[model samples]
Target: MLDLPEDKILPGTTGPALQYVLVADEAFALHKHVMRPYPNKTLDIEKRTFNYRLSRARRYVECTFGILSNKWRVLHTAILVNPDFATEIVKTTCVLHNFVRRRDGLNCNDELLTSDLPTLPNCNTSRPSNAINTRDLFKKYFMEEGKLEWQHNFI
Candidate 1:
């Protein structure tokens, strides 16, 4: 449906550089194609392969959500009185979680992650639960598609 020509797809440069990209759009089967021939050889390879790699590295986001929802269970018993207070509570919870991890120097077992926390069934995303793979995603995607994050270089 995009009808985008091969020349118009401006590849993204932010975050991490990637290589091959394979998009399987059932809605627009014509768009279900790969984007190869990256101009920046130093950054990536082919689009299909790059997509495969990127898919894995983004798994941490889900894991973070799971930890937040399961442990807090705030999603179920939400305090829907004041929007601002609710937002503040969420932020505080996240900060406390990070502080505990840092104070422990990440040495303790990740038992807290798997503890008897409340599990929030539906967060927001429209995709089905089994649509994506979580474990080994980093291994599958990052090694090939991960670009060197720019730490100091502004240009």
Candidate 2:
């Protein structure tokens, strides 16, 4: 249902405009603009390391969604309203969520919210070579320059 343009370039990259990409799970296919974790169990250290870093970065997004869902119970249940209205409700909730978080500074306990939240659905699709290459580049970056101190423990 998400109608994203295939040609959109990602914002905020320092040099050269990279294609806008969505970080998703293995269930989804990678496109020129979408990056997913390397598939299967036989991945090498570099791939595993990449997956770990991606998962760590993805946790923040998941936590934000969890906070939004927790703060607005309506997101937990199926809304009977029109699709447009539902979109408006979600948008309003996001704005309000940011406002509240800014003013109150994340009142919810991180452990409780993150651990208890359900995983979001992935967009099922096939992997394009361009996306695979991009993922590899990101993986290399994480393995080299972008690694954190505690990342070795996971690998």
The residue pairs that clash in candidate 2, if any, are 10-20, 29-125
Cand. 1 Cα-lDDT: 0.43
Model 1 clash pairs are 19-46, 20-46, 20-47, 20-48, 20-50, 21-47, 21-48, 53-141, 56-137
List, residue by residue over 1-155, the lDDT tens digit for candidate 1: 34344522123323232222343222211212332121234533333344443433334544675666655667436577688798788888788778877887877555325434344443333442223322123223433344435411321
Q: Give the poorly placed runs of model 2, Cα more than 4 Å off.
A: 1-16, 79-85, 108-126
Candidate 1 has what TM-score?
A: 0.38
| lDDT (Cα, tens digit) per residue for candidate 2, span 1-155 | 56565553233334333555677666566776667788767999889988887777678677777778888878877778999999999999999878877887866453324445345667665567777777877777677656677888977
Residue 102's lDDT in candidate 2: 86
Per-candidate TM-score against the hidden true structure? 0.38, 0.70
Clashes of each: 9, 2
**Number of the predicted model whose lDDT against the real structure is largest:** 2
